[model samples]
Target: MSAKFHWVLMVVFVCGCHAGAASIAESFTSYKLVPNIVTKAPANVISVKFPSGAVVDLGNELSKPQVALTPSVSWNAGDGLYTVIMFDPDAPSPSNPFISSFLHWLVINVQKDGIASGDTIAEYLHPYPPPFGDIHRYVFLVYQQRERLPVKDFIAYSTIGRFKFSPQDFADNFNLGDPVAGNFFRTQFNSLKTDKLF
Candidate 1:
């Protein structure tokens, strides 16, 4: 077995906590997207071209492929923290109010500075891994941390049991055309203050 699995089992055993070990809240339906790894998101404008390189064809539902962010961005104060978000506009559920979004992958304090090719988000899937399931929309976000986080688990601030971490709070600064939240709405980040020192 991979060392990663052993490490996970050990953590579970040590704490005596049998958490789900995966994102059980929701899933993505559009496409298979992983965080940090660069991918192309097609333009939303009808006249604009799509990433898969096609125009929006409403007739053939499956023909119109989905597009996502390109994995990183370049901004001044904030750029190291990255998150993955998925949402389905047609899902019948509580979070989906016709615009509900499900958080698929959340990676905090990624080594934005020295990240080279061939690096996957797998290194920091401590509390959970990416969730897979029905028609879900996803967004991978990168935030600029005022300070570098020394967390091994991406969800370090996320609540597993009694205590909880409000992820919304961190990304709140960049919400709704807000400079910070809007910075990473659907873009990649580079040139963060914290240069990776590994």
Candidate 2:
């Protein structure tokens, strides 16, 4: 084979491998949970790192030390404004999820990079699973917006009740098409202190 042909083949092989790896990673239950609820296919993968330097992976069990502080989130958004939402779909308890999908945090007009460049529509709420609650999935979803949304008109505050949260309804209300990126981590009941940011 010609040298140039071999080079092209190598590049294709590498890209294919990378894509395959991403596909496998996104298949985890934690990753699929968001899409299943939102009725959209997952896109970009978010990288979340806690203050203690622990990296978040699909379904990884995190305790108070791992979730006490808001983790740094980064994702690949080519351009345009975006929105970030972090919520727990297994609120109170999984078996009896009467108040499922409690909103933890919300930000609007996030730049292509991440939350740091966005407007804080809702302040961050640290994860605090009830002592008797089952393992909860805290999901972070990023959506590319058609335009800057009138979020303030919709939500008065970030710490709203868990009963009213509906990811699908939120997306439809704001015309936020399918999510551009998403990630999640699991946390169970822990004895460590859970402090409020305020």
Total backbone collisions, model 1: 21
| TM-score, one value per model | 0.30, 0.83
| 1-198 per-residue lDDT for model 2 (tens digits) | 899999999999999867844763455443557355677645567788889787777667877666777788888778799888888888778877778778888889888876787888677787878879578888888888998776666565465544558887888878897777777788887654443331
Task: Name the regions of candidate 2 deviating beyond 4 angstroms.
Answer: 1-36, 192-198
Looking at model 2, the pairs that clash are none
lDDT of each: 0.29, 0.75
Name the runs in model 1 displaced over 4 angstroms.
Answer: 1-64, 68-100, 111-141, 155-198
Predicted structure 2, TM vs. truth: 0.83
Error of 1 at 75 (Å): 4.8
